[model samples]
Target chain A: MTDEQRLYSIWVYLQAEPLFWLTLTIGAYLVGDFCYRRSNLFPLFNPVALSIIIVSGVLLIFDIQYERYFEGAKFIHFLLGPATVSLAIPIYQKWALIKSNAMPIISAVLLGSVFAILITYLLALAFSLEREIVLSLLPRSVTAPIAMGISELIGGIPSLTAIITIITGIIGAAFGTFTLDLLRVKKMSARGFGIGLASHGIGTARAMSRDKTAGVFAAVAMGLSGVVTALIVPLIIFLLKI
Target chain B: MLESIFLIFLFQLVGEMIQKFFELTIPGPVIGLVLLLVALLLFGKYSTSVKTRLEKGLTTTAEYLLGHLPLLFVPIGVGVVMHISFLENRLLAVLFVIFSATVLSIGFTAFVMEKLQNLGNQNDG
Candidate 1:
């Protein structure tokens, strides 16, 4: 074979390997991170958003199927579980703060979760969206795994729920702090908890980058809101009969 | 590092098992988190040294993992490709709902929490 054909064969071989996609995922994220830092950590220039755009652009250009890319990238995705469990460390470390503010924290999360669901539900209805779409959107505020489970139980499309959950997270991470600032919510714990309650892990991650106290409270809020939403969504479904 | 990772995964495994057996709505990792927290609390009561060691290992591991937490979600975010057509039609409505709800909820929660905290402090003082 000619030199060009030989190179093409190597390219085709690498495309089928999981390592290739894994590298692309990490590499794209690093580039996105660099840009985010360069942009002075601007929320709109979010690393996850940038990484998604880069990876998606490459996949589109190469005509690679998302499933094929996912095959390799699932390794990273799998880490989300352990990472979530590891949040216990921070929660434990901040137990005293959490214990003292338990009442406020609990009330905020409970109310925030209900508000998120109610507003999303009403808006989806106002838009006259389909029932399954509405159901999928209901869990959009929770973490992806829990949201996906809730979606399945509530007769929504699980995959769509995952996508919606991610989008909601991105929106929250991008705008959460700014919104808090607008409302004059200056306390780190309150800001973190609010973000986590409305946006889950992604918001917590953003809160982590901003402040340690914020990070811990965000972790606490993320876990609490996950449980609260899980309980409340079903009750709402039963009450509304939707 | 390795031991911490193993412990984290072990908790997640047991959590998954429990979730499956009980048909619980909560995710396995979350259950694992609760279990790990309780374990730490209980272990701390018995031996401070052991609890500290465990906490050190876990803190290192958790920091490393969570430091790059945003990276983990990239793969799924890329899955947006599969729904381009579906999103294209409903993009405006979806964005509107998500944007408004997220902002309003965050504002409402933070505002309420801050207000409540101030109230508590005033009462304590």
Candidate 2:
């Protein structure tokens, strides 16, 4: 065989390996991270968004199926489970603060989650979007992995839910502080908890950069809201009978 | 680090089993999180030093994972390309819904939280 044919054979062999795609996934994210940093960590320059665009473009160009790409990338995806379990560490660490602020945190999360779900549902309905689309949007305020699971359980497209969740997070990260400032909500705890309740991890990251107190509250809010949304969403769906 | 990861996975495995047995809607990882939180709370009440050590190990691993948490979602995000058709005509509507809901929800929560906190302070005073 000619050198060109030999190179083609090697390419075909590498494509079948999980390591190749896993490396590509990480490499693509690094590039996205570099750009994100270069832009001063702007919320709009979201690393996940950039990485998705790059990876998707590559997959499209190569005609590689998403399932094939996922086979390798699942290694990274699997960490989401353990990472979630680790959330308990921070919650445990901040147990005292949580206990003291229990009333406000609990009330705010419950109100915020219900408002988010209800508003999204009403708007989607008014726009006359598809039913499944509306269901996917219901959990858009939650973290991506949990939101995606909720979407799947509720008969919506999981991938679509992931995108919607990310978009919602970006919006929260971008405009959360600004909105809070406009309302004259100066307390760092309030600001952080509000953003976290509405936006999840991305918003928490943004809150962290602003203040340590805000970061802790944001993290706790994100964790609490995730659980609350999961429980209440099904209940709401059943009650509304939609 | 390995031990921390093993413990996390063990919790998740048990969480998964619980979910399966109860036929609940809650996901395994989330259930794992609550279980771990309870375990830590209980353990902390009994032993501070050992709890601190365990927490330190878990913190290092958790932070490492969460620091790059955004990266973990890339694969699923890329899958959006597959569902591009679903989003094509409704992109504007989706964007509007997400934007408005997020902004309003954030504002409402912050306002209420701030008010409640102030009320608590007044009572204390």
**lDDT (C-alpha) at residue A178 in model 2:** 75
Give each model's whole-structure lDDT. 0.87, 0.83
DockQ of 2: 0.54
User: lDDT (0-100) at residue A144 of candidate 2?
Assistant: 81
**What ranges in model 1 sit over 4 Å off?**
A238-241, B48-50, B122-125
Model 1 C-alpha lDDT per residue in residues A1-242, reported as the tens digit of each score: 99999999998998889999999999999999999899987878888899999999999999888998898899999998998899888888878888888788878888888988998999999999889889999988888888998999899988888888888888888889889878898888888888988899888888886677788888888888888898899999899988
The per-residue C-alpha lDDT of model 2 at residue A68 equals 89
**Candidate 2, overall lDDT?**
0.83
DockQ (CA atoms), all models: 0.62, 0.54
Top model by TM-score, which number? 1
- Candidate 2: misplaced stretches above 4 Å? A143-163, A173-188, A201-216, A230-242, B48-52, B121-125
Worst 10 residues of 2 chain A by lDDT: A205-214
In model 1, pairs of residues that clash are none
Could you give the interface RMSD of candidate 1 in angstroms?
2.5
